[model samples]
Target: MRGHPVTAMHPDHYESPAGLYLHIPFCVAKCGYCAFTSYPCGNAPPPDYLVALRQQAERLARHPMVREQRFATLFVGGGTPTVYGGAELGGLIRECLTLFNFDPEPEVTVEANPNSVELAKLAALREAGVNRLSIGVQSFSDRLLRGIDRSHSRAEALAAVAAARSAGFANLNLDLIYGLPEQSLADWRETIAVALAQNPEHLALYGLSVEEGTPFHRRSEQGGLALPDEETVQEMEDFAYGQLATAGLPRYEISNFARAGRSSRHNENYWHNGNYLGLGAAAVSCLGHLRFRQVPEPERFVRLINDGAPPFIEMEALPPAAAFRETVIMALRMLEGIAVAELAARFGVTPQDYYGKTFVRLQAQGLLAVEDGFLRLTARALPVANQVLAELV
Candidate 1:
């Protein structure tokens, strides 16, 4: 297999520890707006699902490339990992630790939903070496949650946060969504206020998008989904940026905010365009210049693993120039952005040499700026970041 050209130039950078991601595809119920690959399995994954996952892990753990590099982070995310019983989830974590080579101070995280998680589950995860807990508290309003077809209520969300705190997790992240149907600026303010009251170390804010094939998409096509106006949604974003900054959880990435030293290491690895190994159905992996994803269906993925077939159904081998552009685009999501000098050092290609006329045009439009050696989006360009990024890529 051909490696990234930069790997020869900077061997240490390519050989450094990679992040690990495990997908839990089981959920209690599918939300109306969700497009993630998930099966509504009532609560936990089937027994055979875990067996297939273990086989995949063992296979990867024995690979020469995987064994050579230590892992610095492990993120367990899914339809709802907390749906599994406390003891069961704890055992899974333990098995992963024994099967992989991890950094001495790895940051292990698991995503949970409010209705599926309790104090006992939280405590068990903490004991199993999960230092970070991210709870999907999409909204604090019961009405908004119901409108989106979330299984959890406002009370359950609040209790989940309190329970995580009591379980010895000091590092916590809350996920929130803005611009729901019939939601107002005042409603968004209340949601942010309630989230702040919990004193979480990190916050992830997302705007609701009507994706294809979702119920929301169908409603939008039929003119039935009463989504907030674009202007009101923009207002909500502005308010959240200022409010969270004042609360000392400033925006570190476009959608992620963190207190000092609390940024997610696993996610940061991605923003840096670093290597990562992903296991389970629909999970994606990036190593060197190769990117691939497992089969989207859980049942199919399990069968493939058991049948001794490679689970990846799609793969891409990016050329050096494409990979360079990808790295820059991903890094630009960070608030501090990518260091122009660092890129030149690692890739031996300066932004001026690579981007050329496009770079000059964006900088002239005041949409992109180089400040203190970093190429970052200016405040004026933040709201239109998607457009700006498309131009770069």
Candidate 2:
């Protein structure tokens, strides 16, 4: 069973960058539709959180496997990493650099929300060697922002982009959300237009999913949430594909668009099933066949680290076959899809060997296609890609 824990490491794995991910759990406030592991901390994280993080990083750095690896990318993400002052976040990155072996030109990225960022802070981050900025600008509509309980306004989002450029960040990514309650197709189109005016290097567009425990989910249960109809939502996605491509930002993945040479290397490593080390509360890591996550509660995580104990709350191992299956699924997320022969050579198993029947079935159904040497979803499956990919899993 996929859920059963195993202990063997796969012989062959991804030949891509080893990335590092640091999670910050504090946020100004939770979004109505957010389900991520985050807490509502007023302005910044508790003083002890960074201490615990530093302790955990120092402990992980001494492991034989970790010490031998050189990281190619580092991403500081969270509820909002910008909540910490630029100097504080930069200090954390500088410490990680000394503790870990990073590539000469590693891509260092930090996630921020417009409301929590300012020019001085951004400049400090740039000075600390952060080369990339990913700002959460869900929409440029004050009405939409309020509807989702977002703290930032349209003006703040625009200012954030200008500030990032002024701070000397050449690589930047902006996130936008669609299918919000009471959002019309016109509204989505306007948001995309506003985002394009910033000319960011990358754009991550996501459709809203109301998960359990989110305010949106409860509102939905009570039949109070108003969302665009399915057809309208599909049209919005199609429009974005054409619009962004026309703007020289082509779709590389289902939810991501980027200018040439600006795709997120950290996220690409993930899509390629490469190894990464994660730190901080609720952070997840995948090494060889071992996968685990830190304790979700920030307080408990800090206690564990302070007490010199592992903070992991969940751990699982993936057998080779299971790992290969996962690689295919994650690869399918990229528009380029999977290189059939290359993966087969690397894993010593063809897609046919593991999923021949499923492949034939989906291919016959027009949801998948093998073109040239790659196996990818068909154009017909792009809109319903999630459903099509789930069938393989």
Candidate 3:
């Protein structure tokens, strides 16, 4: 079954997730700004890690919730999923498919670093049913790429895209980062121009965030980082929006742009607050009112899975209020905004009733607006979304 067959109940009452996320925590080299739970694995992933992943998939497949579910999207994201051999990665995908009842046209996506991807790997992944490729082309400037300690050169980034095209990957997303230290507006503009030249199906543009414990954070604390000024960063964002729109890739979410009908289904599921099962080291899963997070350390993850025990380090059953807040926060990230009636139906409380005066005040400040029946951030409010969203919580 593609999904649980519905009875006479309203469709909204039968909400079930159709998405899955697999985390690959192995990387050739950790980027300076990255704080994700990933570590260097040199030439290839540890063989044991693959075995653990398969075990985890098999265990989850037997779970009652998983058995009742039919996934329509499977996203293999990572610290560089391409670090594993193509055949190995394909085998993992096949294993997941066998363990889960996936849709015939499920959107399977894999993340790759430009330095590790090749024509052979791309072909292997394509043959394995991966229809989309999201390449980590963080910057087109060689100097900026080095500043972030990225392993891929600008040439390698371009070559990776060319190879994916040759391998018949028509759906591709190039990830770009702005607000890097020493990144000028012109540098960002040139990066956008080069990325647009490739005509990717999607673009994920994110501003650099100096997370604590990362190398970038340490450098900033030591007064060594020279990040662009706030005004310049805002200009860079505006420029990207304009340039991407002109290239026919319009912004569907705050940080993502896509060609018509090409937006990431897996990501959209997240934005809609849909349920998803995540597997592998440090993976997170959200089903119904409960959320679970796996152990961050790969070795520990493998040990627990091999021992036939749950690898989760933490599990929480969200209170109603907390779930409502999370749903609103995620839904607001989309340009389309959230339907107030739907939100009320899902949460058992209208946004205005819950947020009360703060909601009205934000609307009065022109930071938020209610058009038709939807509540959304205004254009001026998007740049300061964190501040605006904080008010609700």
Model 2, residue 94: C-alpha shift (Å): 1.2
* Tens-place lDDT digits, model 3, residues 90-129: 9999889778988888899999999899999999999998
* Candidate 1 Cα deviation (angstroms), residue 186: 1.4
Prediction 3 TM-score vs. true: 0.95
- Candidate 1: misplaced stretches above 4 Å? 1-16
Candidate 2 has its poorest 10 consecutive residues by lDDT at 1-10
Candidate 2 runs further than 4 Å off: 1-13
- Model 1 deviation from the true structure expressed as Cα RMSD, one decimal place: 2.9
lDDT of each: 0.88, 0.88, 0.89
Candidate 1 displacement at residue 384 in angstroms: 0.6
Counting clashing residue pairs in each candidate, in order, gives 0, 0, 0
